[model samples]
Target: MSDALLSLENIRTDIAQYHILKGVSFSVPRGQVTMLLGRNGVGKTTSLRTIMGLWQAKEGTLTFDGADITGAPISARARAGIGFVPEDMGIFGDLSVEENMVLAATNGMPDPARLEWLFSAFPALRTFWKSQAGALSGGQKQMLSIARAMIEDRKLYLIDEPTKGLAPAIISTMVGALRTLKQQGATVLMVEQNFSVAKALGDQAVVMDDGVVVWTGAMAELAESSALQERLMGLSMEAH
Candidate 1:
């Protein structure tokens, strides 16, 4: 993709003696959401970790906004306009919600307008501003994790399964928040197991199987074809 904000070319990652990503390749187009879909243990999480430099790629190139960052440290990548929301949510349970957001801001303080916008999107963050993060519900904690990443504007966001294990209502809230991000022209590459959420927000889709990319195309195309979804992901879209 000519307008790709991030591109991974033949990325390979290994954990000890185990190979996780076997030459994975994909591009995330700027100002759009790209869905990284695959079943459990197919290296989807490892791919996101490699892009964030949490797990170094043994081979291949990582280009962000036309600059090669394959060897860059995690901090350097974060400084160079990349935000990551891991599968664990990476929240500081001991801290207050307000404190967490403050810590996520690069300047030590979030912009008042941006904070207000986030509060509007996730009202629970505002309600629990001074409350301990550990006291929040699972869904609220997930909202805090995503809100922290969105506290500072970045060129791209790598998010892992924002709606996993949530109730339908909570998932709807998450979907709305992500739609707001898209409206603001944020570029995101997300790994989501929920087919409904993927179809709702993804502009492009990249499917992985056994540590390698098996398919890449428009999300709508994949959504419209149950056969393609079944072939790539081992289940039809309706199964979700």
Candidate 2:
């Protein structure tokens, strides 16, 4: 992929005595949403951690924007315009919503334009500005997590299951926000289990099984093929 902003080639990782992400490889295209999908325990989160340098890759290479980042530090990755929204949301429970967003800004101050856009995208953030993050609802917390990542202008965003445990309404709002991000020219690599949401937001799709890529193609093609979706997702149509 010549236009890939983030490329992972033969990536491998291990945890203690357990080996995960065996020879995983893929490329996330610039200014588009690429989805990583698979069953549970299929090295989804591990791959993200390795890319962020939270989990060291024992082998293979990672390149971001034509620069080798296999050995880059976590802070360095962030400084290089890579933003991450972990599964746990990674928010300060004790801090106010406004305070959390302020802390995520590169210079410790959120840009007024970006802040206004965020408030418009997630009105709850504006409403709960002074409220602690721990007091927010699940959907609001997810919004804050994403808001924090977007506080800074980044080249790529790595978000994990943003709709997990949220109501249908909130999920709809999240999907719209993700689409807007792509429209704003921010490349996105996301891991999601919801077939509907994945189809809605993904431009490219990669399916992983047993720590390696099993399938890769356009999201529209994957959405049209029930057989392929079942084979990769390990679930029946009714379940999905």
Candidate 3:
């Protein structure tokens, strides 16, 4: 993209006396997915939270569309076109699928055109529109979480893990959905532990270790080089 939608420069953060993010830096181009890859406890989740202002970073500059938002409240960031889907999926189990959708309806109406578009992309969500969120399957809940993030005219998407517990087929479906999101021009910053899922859809890979970004490059580069993956991601694959 010619212009960046969101950028994080040298971010440092701490939580409860334990230092987490250490000078993390990366940026998402307009309409592209930037995957954050690393082993568990590498502080990938913390990076997303700090970006959302859920955990204030001790240092770093966070800019959204050229405006400094390092100190902006989470709600303020949400209002400024930042949509977040955490590892937990952040679904309201007490609410029905439709109710969950309704909770996010505001300046952006539940416009028939948009809803139809989303429903077309995710038919499962349409099937369980009236079902309670807690009653849905894991894949269904993931769909709901992603759908809710896309409810508004969101400029950037901060998605933690969209394919954690899904079956292979469902993972493919989620990958397809992310491709559609990219096609529709949504800037995405995703954190994925599943190497296959990230390799399939991510444009670039941001490899983090011990709370700081250690490596970054095109997805193809990450996939083609096994040694790089093994060293940075602790991934090992056997010939099939």
lDDT of 2 by residue, 1-240 (tens): 439999999999999998898999999998889999999899999999999999999999999999999999999999999999999999999999989998999998998998999888898999999999999999999999999999977998999989999999999889888888888888999999888998888899999998999999999889888888788877643356
lDDT tens digits by residue: candidate 3, 95-141: 89888887876653576777887798789888998889999999889
User: Residue-wise lDDT of candidate 1 within 1-240, one digit each (tens)?
Assistant: 539889999999999999999999999999999999989999999999999999999999999999999999999999999999998999999999999999999999999999999998899999999999999999999999999999988999999999988889989989999999999999999999999999999999999999999999999999999989888888886688
- Clash pairs, candidate 3, are none
lDDT of each: 0.94, 0.92, 0.85
Using Cα atoms with residue i matched to residue i, what is each candidate's TM-score against the true structure?
Answer: 0.98, 0.97, 0.94
- Model 2 bad stretches (over 4 Å): 236-239
Candidate 2 to truth, TM: 0.97
The alpha-carbon deviation from the true structure for residue 216 of candidate 3, after best TM-score superposition, in angstroms, is 1.2
Q: After superposition, how far is residue 173 of candidate 1 from its true place, in Å?
A: 0.9
lDDT of 3 at 157: 90
